[model samples]
Structure formats: structure tokens, C-alpha cells
Target: MRAVVIEQPGTVSVQDVPDPIPGPGDLVVAVRGAGICGTDIHLLDGELPYDRYPIVPGHEFYGEVVDVAGDIDRARIGRLVTVDPNMPCGACAECRRGRANLCERYEALGVTTDGAAAELVRVPAGLAYDLPADVSDVGAVLTEPLACAIHGFDGLPRRPQDRYLVYGAGTMGLMMGLLAADMTSEPVTVIEPNPSRRALAESFGMRAVSSPEEVDPDERWESVIDCTGVVEAIEDGLGRVRRGGVFQCFGVTETDAMVKLRPFDIYRNEITVIGSMAVHNSFDRAHRLAQVWGDEKLAPLVTHGYALDDYAEAIRTFRDGAGLKIAIRPGGLA
Candidate 1:
């Protein structure tokens, strides 16, 4: 099988590797469509603490079940499915509390183990969800990220008519805006510096701005989310949250990243600041969202595609911020 292998931090290669074999209760999927996200870049640069080097690195993907372990149902073979790549150690206290995403010994397909940036990959059967007929292949590739965003809202306390302000208009920020619009029954406001991304956001009928200054100076949002993972964006977003409003951080930042917040402001404004991580019992909901908002609503986010052999090109495109979402088709770039 051909795969994208990260030999180590700053070292990557496309090479022939042994075909992944399913373990007990596992399924072998022939990779169909995979997405190259920020996490993949982090894994390549050795930025994530969870990344284990010399690993196949693709977490967001959907495929057809080619084979299954003896304990699994044979009926699952040939089914189109997307997986929740998060593999939590079920015995951990966090897992026992049903907060598996924060498991002490957290493992995932692309981070700690080999992932689907190959002709085939193996994953737990229980984590796989069948893609609905209404969901397009491109939309299926978005399920993992969408699930993570859905989990963001799950951690949030929503109020009817709450206005949302998202700090970025990239893939995650766009998804957050869509979800916020649905929940708040208001046009989600977005701040993006990139003209292309701002155009994409507006094409989705979102109210976008180049800077927060463009919005009414007297106005603040009830809900503010920082999806850029940049210290500047976080700091700016915190200041824009209305009094008694909630600020959600849904982006990933480096270990050493820090921001200064006025403790007095938080106390006097009654502001609530929260952090949201990966998918937490939201995979099924994400699959359902694909059914409801699949090709028409979400697939537009995909603006680029690449062959597995062109993983490096995909990474370059990502780092350049060339598109909204870049898809890796294991079968072919087309």
C-alpha cells in the first residue's frame, strides 16, 4: 500500500508500506476521501504533544469497508462509512465519566497511530458511522471536523437570539458560523483578513468584515468564538464579548502560547471563558448534520483536492492558505 509517512519532525515521504490488517473488532477501510487539516501540519512540524513520529497522518477521512475482524458483522463489508478517529482508552477516569475526548491516555488514528493517508487503514468498528445516501463524498470528509465544532456548541450555553462573532473565516470558523447561525437564528458575523476567505464566507450569506472596527463601535456580541488560535485574535475576541456573554476558544495553539487577560474585567463583566477540544460524543450528531446539510450546505467548503502521493503539495497549499478545505483522495487526485 502507498502511504504518506512522516519519518520524523520535518521529514516526510511517500513510500510503500504493509497493508493495514484489522485487529479484533476492527475494520479495514479502503481510503476514499481524506482531509489535510491544521492537525496534520502540526504532526508534520512536530508541534503536537500527541504526535508519534514515523506515522501515517490523516485523521479526517471516509471509506468503504473492505474487510472486518472475525468478531465484526460481515454485513458491514462494502459499506460507505466515516470514522471518529479519536481512540480513547476506555479505562481512564475521563472515559469512565463519558468524557472520552479528554482521556488521560488519549489515542487517535493519525496522531499516536497510523492513519488513513494510505490505500487502506484499520480502525475500530464501533467508531465508524455509515454515511447516508444524501451525504456527498466531499461532505463525508468534513464529518470529523464538523463533529469537533458541534462539540464546541455542546459545551456552550445557548440563548435564543444570541449574536455570534467568530474570529476567523477559515474552515473551522466557517463551520462555527454555520452552526451559530442555526442556533441563534441570526446571521453570524465573521472577521477575516483574507479576501478569498471573506468572499467564501459571504457566499455562504454570512456577514463578514475585515476587522472588528467595521462593526458598530457600540455593539458587542453575546457569543464570541476565537477559531484562529492566534494570540492576537484571542485577545481581540475577548474584548468583543458583551457583558455577561460567553467566549469560546475552539482553536488549537502551541503549548507555550499565552495571553494576558484582565482579571478585573472578567469579574466586573461577568464574562465566561471556556475552552473546547476535540469530538466528545458528537460523532453521530455530525453524521446527521451531513445528512441535513451535506452537499448543498457543507460541500462548498472543499476548494482543493490532491492525490495521496501529493501530500507535500497539499501541505504547502494549506500553509499558503490557498483554499477552504483540501481533500486527499487516496484513489487519485481527480
Candidate 2:
């Protein structure tokens, strides 16, 4: 099996590895597609505390089941499935409170364990969600991230008519914009410094701009989300939240990063500042939403696809921000 191996911090390679064998209750998935995100970069740099070395680094992935372990349903074989990478310890204090995303012992497939950036991967059968036959590989690959975005939205105040201002028109930001547009029946404005991304955002019907100042100076958003994870964007977005609106930090910022915010204003304005970590019970709903959006919108978000051996090029393209959603087609699918 060919897999992308991060042997250590700041080190990665694409090479032949032993095919994964499913353990009891596990299933072997023949990797069809996988999406790359900032989390992969953090894992490569050893920035994530939970990431283990010599692991295959892909979590936003979907594939067909090839084999099943003992005690698993044989009917799972050949079912196209998207996995919920986060496997929280169900006995943790957070899990007991239904906050499993903040589980005391967080175990994610691509982070704490070997992931699906390979020809084959062994994942827990219970974590896999079956996809409809009509779902495109691109749609399946995005379910994980869309699930995270759904979880982010779950923490916000639900008001479809409320104006949304999102930072970073990357895949995550665009997905957030999709959320606003899908719910509000109108486009969401996006702030992205990259001209290419700004243009891409416009294609998604976003009012794209280089800076917040480009928007009307008197305008504010009922929902201001910083999907860039950059402290500058976070701070700028914090100041633009409407008096009684909510601010969401949906991006994965550096662990050591800090931003200054006025607590007095938050109290005086009755503002709600919230943070979303990862997927909770939102994976299924995300797949459903993906079907709705993918019918017309989601497929185009996948602007680039690379073969298994070109994983480095995929990373390069991702870092260069050359495309919207870059994915790895391990099976060499179109």
C-alpha cells in the first residue's frame, strides 16, 4: 500500500507501507479520496500535541469498504463511507456532558492514529457513515470538514437573516459562507487577503474583499466568523460583531497565539464570543447538507486533485493557496 508517512516533525514521505489489517470491530477502507487542510500542516510540524509520528496524515476522507474485521458486519464490504475521525473516550467527563469534542482523551484518526492518506486504511466501523449512491467523491471528501463547520454553526445563534462576515476565503471560510448563503437565501461577504481566494469567494456569491475596510465602514455583522485563525483577523473580526450579535472563531489558530479583546465591551454590548473545536454528532447532518449543496455548489469547491505519490505537490499547492479545495485521489479516480 502507498501511504503518506510523516516520520517525524517537519518530515514527510510518500512510500510503500504494509496494508492495514482491520482489528476486531474495524473495517479496511480502500481510500478513494481525501481532503487536505491546515491540520495536516500542523501535524507535519509537530504543532499538535496529540499527533503521533510515522502516521498516515489524512482525516477528511471517504472510501469503499474492502474488508471487515471479526465481529463486524460483512454487509459493510463495498459500502462507500465517510468516517468521523474524532473517536472520543466515551467515559470522559466531557463526553458525559455531551461535549465529546472537548473529550479529556481526544483520539482522532489522522492525528493520534494512522489515517487514510493511503491505498487502504483500517477505521472503526461505528465511525463510518454511509454515503448515498449519488454522492460524488468530492462530496464525500468534504463531509468531514463540513461536519466541523456544522459543529461550528451549532455553537452560534441561529438567525438565518442575520448578516454574516467571514474571514479567510479558504475552503473553511468558503464553507462558512456557504452556510450563510444556504440559510439566509443571500450571499455572505468574505475578507481574504489573497486575490485568488477573493475571486474564488466571489464565484461562491460572496462579496469578497481584501480587508474589512473594503466593506461599508458603518456596517457590522450579526455573525462574524474568523476562519483564517490569524490573530489579526480574529482581532479585526472581534471589533466588528454587531452590538447583540455573536462572534465565532472557527479556524485552528496556533496554540500559543493570543489576541487582545475588551471584556467591558463584550459585557456592555451583550456580545457572545464562542469557539468551535471539531466534529461532534454533526457528521451525518453534514453529509446531508453536502448532498444539498453538492448538487450545484460543493463539487466546484474541489479545484484540484493529485495522485497518491504527488502528496508533496498537493501540500505545496495547498500552501501556495493555488486552488480552493485540494484533494488526494488515492485510487486515481477522476
Candidate 3:
């Protein structure tokens, strides 16, 4: 099996590796489509808090089940499925409290373990969800990221008719805008500096602007989301929240990064600030949504695709912000 191996931070290679053998209660999947995420870049640059080198780096993926462990149902073989990569320690207090996404002992595919940037990968059967036949390959691959966006919505005070203001028009921000559009009758507004991204957001029917200044200075949103993971965006978004509104930090940022906030303003305005981590019992719902929106909406988000051997090019394309969602097809592009 050929896999993308990150020998260490700043080092990557495509090399032959042993085919994955499923452990008990696990299944081996022949990789089909895998989406490259910003976290992958972080892993490559050693920006993450922990180090898991010599590891394959892909988690947003789906594929056909090629084999199953002895304990798993044999009928699962050949089924197309999407996996939830976050593996939380079931015994953790957070898990007990139904907040497993914040598990103290966190391990996830592509982060702490070898993942789907390969011809074959092993995943726990419990984490795998059978993707509906109606879901396109692009939709199936997006289940993980959509699940994270769903979790982000779960953290919001989702009142009916609440307006949404989102920072960044990148993949995650666009998804957030899509979800926000569905949640309320109000138009969703997205702030994106890139002209192309802003145009893409407008094509999706969202109000897109180059900066907050472009929007009415007095305008405020009931739900403000910062998806850029940028300090400037986060700071700007905080000030745009309406009185008693909720602000969610949906993007990943440096662990030590700090943003200036007016504590007094927040206290007086009764604003709530929250952070959404990863998937939390949302994969199945995201998969269902993908089935509903696959060809019509979700699939269009995948603007680029690459063969497994072209992982380097995929990374470059992603870093250059050349497309919306870039997929790596380990089994070759369809």
C-alpha cells in the first residue's frame, strides 16, 4: 500500500507501507476520497500541541470496506462508508458528561495515528457510518468537516430569525453560511478578503464582503462566527455581536494565541462567547445531510481533486487557497 507519510515536521514522502490489518471490531477500507484540511497543514508545520510523526495525515475521508475484523459483520465488506476520526477515551470524564469532543485523552485518525492518506486504512467499526448511495464521492468525503460545522451550530444560541455574520469565506466559513441560511430566513453575511472567495460566497446566495467596513457600521448579528482562525477576524467579529448574541470561535488557532476583547462591553451587552472543537455525535446527522444535499449543494464545494501521489501538489494548492475543497483520491480520481 502506498501512503503519504510525514516523516517529521516539515518532511513528507509518498512511500510503500504495509497494508493495514483491522484489529478486533475494526474494518479496513480502501481509500477513495480524502479531503485536505487546515489541520493537515498544522501537522506538517509542527504547529499542533502534540507531535505524532511518521504518520499518515488524512482524516476527512470515505471509502469502500475491503475487509473486516473477525468480530465485525462480514456483510460490511464492499459497503461505502465515511468515518468519524475523533477517538475519545470512553472512560474520560468528558465522555461521561456527553462532551467527548473534549476528551482528555484524545486520539484521532491522521493526528495521533496512521490515517486514510493511503491505499488502505483501518478504522474502528463503531466510528464508521454507511454513506447513503445517493451521496456523491465528494459528499461522502466531506462528512467529517460537515460534522464539525454541525457541532459548531450546536454551540450557538440558535433562535429563529437570528441573523448570522461569519468571518472568512473559506470552506468551513462557506459551510457555516450554508447552515446558517438553512437555520434562519435572514440572509447570511460572510466577510472574506479574497475576491474569488467572496464571489464564491455570493454564488451560494450569501452576502459577501471584503471587510466588516463594507457592512453597515451599525449592523450587528445575533450569531457571529469567526471561521478564519485569525486574530484580527476574531477581534472584529466579537464587536459585531448583537446585544445578548452568541459568538462562536469555529476555527483552529495557535494554542497560545490571544485576542483583545472588551470585557466590559461583553458584560454590559450580555454577549456569550464559545468555542466549538470537533465532531460530537454529529457524524450520522452530517452524513444524512450530505445525502440530502450531495449533488445539489455539497458536491459543488469540492473544487479540486488529486491523485494520492500528488499529495504535495494538493498541499500547495490548499496553501495557495486555490480552491474551495481539495480532495486526494488515493484510489485515483473518478
Which candidate ranks first by lDDT, i.e. highest? 3
Local accuracy of candidate 2 as per-residue lDDT tens digits, 1-334: 9999999998899999999989999999998999998889889888888646788999999999999988888988989998989999999899999999999999999888999889999999999989887777677889999999998988878686888999988888888888888778656889998888888788878899998778777788899999988999999998899999999989978888999999998999899999999898899899877877774778768889999999999999988878788889998956
Model 3, span 1-334: residue lDDT tens: 9999999999999999999988899999998999999889999999887777889999999999999986799999989999999999989899899899999999999988999999999999998999765558777988899999999998897888999999998889988999999989888999999998888889889999998889888999999999989998999999999999999999887888999999999999999999999899899899888877786787668999999999999999999889789999998877
lDDT of each: 0.89, 0.88, 0.91
- 1 against 3, candidate with superior lDDT: 3
For TM-score, the strongest prediction is 3
Ranking by TM-score: 3, 1, 2
**Candidates 1 and 2: which is better by TM-score?**
1
Regions of candidate 2 where Cα sits further than 4 Å from its true position: none
Candidate 3, after superposition: displacement of residue 301 in Å? 1.3
Candidate 2: residue 13 lDDT (0-100): 94
TM-score of each prediction: 0.97, 0.96, 0.98
Query: Between 2 and 3, whose lDDT is larger?
Result: 3
Error of 2 at 199 (Å): 2.4
| CA error at residue 122 for candidate 3, angstroms | 0.3
- Write the residue-wise lDDT of candidate 1 on 73-138 in tens digits: 999998999999998989989899988989999899988999989989999999899986555876
Cα RMSD, model 3? 1.0
Model 2 clash pairs are none
